[model samples]
Target: MEEAPKTLAHQIGGIQNDALRFGLHGVKSDLVGSHPLDVAHRSTIKTHEDMKRKVLANTYGSAFPLKMDLDRQILTRFQRPPGPIPSSMLGLEALNGSLDDFGFEDYLNDPRESEVYRPQDMHHGMEVRLGISKGPVCPSFV
Candidate 1:
């Protein structure tokens, strides 16, 4: 008689089976809906990058790692439902201005916000003060 193959789950007392089930649940959760800004991938990287820089320039260079409210506006524009691109979002001039100035204006301040502006770190002397000067620049991978 031929013996049946044992699953890793059986050998490990069902832990592997539990882990696989957990992973499948996570995948199912992802399929339930598209996440905000996921539609941005349909746009070219050049479009996104230009949009990001335009955003930063208008915010006087303070908008990188965008805040929640700004994130929502970008999401809404990219996910516009089955229609022509909005007139306000349609030209070279639009790219030169902030979204707030162009009619998609809901500038809600996020309840959780942090300042991202920092002066350039021109000196290497701080490395010694932080006790990291002696650390390996790249640790040996092996």
Candidate 2:
């Protein structure tokens, strides 16, 4: 109930600029999702549309018929960071067998993910690992 305004307030407010004003949307006086917006927007909703629907329903009331085309364009523009990032890491974990294991390795090489971790068949001019820790996070585990 708290989120309804935050998600679509801009769109709802935009109603003034356009023609059809749906009722006032719920302003995000508080969190109404699986997570908070700062963290949720990053960790939870992975895509623009996902964020849009989540916010819209939380903010205003309905997900149908956004206020205007510009709203949609803005919503669609945001995108998840490259898949190769998680894929590269998860791929290793998944391959390690059943321990910290889950997810598809193919996903790392998937077009959606960056090409840094290219398909086995593909060749790269260079291979550089970034932001990876050399030692285990948990000393005991290492």
* Clashing residue pairs found in predicted model 1: none
Tens-digit per-residue lDDT, 1-142, candidate 1: 9988775322221232243222222455456776557766656666986787677667765555355446557644542222222223443335444533534233665222325322222222234234434221111100
Give candidate 2's whole-model lDDT.
Answer: 0.37
**Local error of candidate 1 at residue 51 (angstroms):** 11
Instruction: Give each model's whole-structure lDDT.
Output: 0.40, 0.37
TM-score of structure candidate 1? 0.17
Q: Work out how many backbone clashes candidate 1 has.
A: 0
Kindly list the per-residue Cα lDDT of model 2 for residues 1-142, writing each as its tens digit. 4555544322212222222222233446234644456886566545765676667667776644355334546544444333323223433333323345444754465444444323221111011022221221111111
lDDT of 2 at 11: 26
- Quote model 2's TM-score: 0.15
TM-score of each: 0.17, 0.15
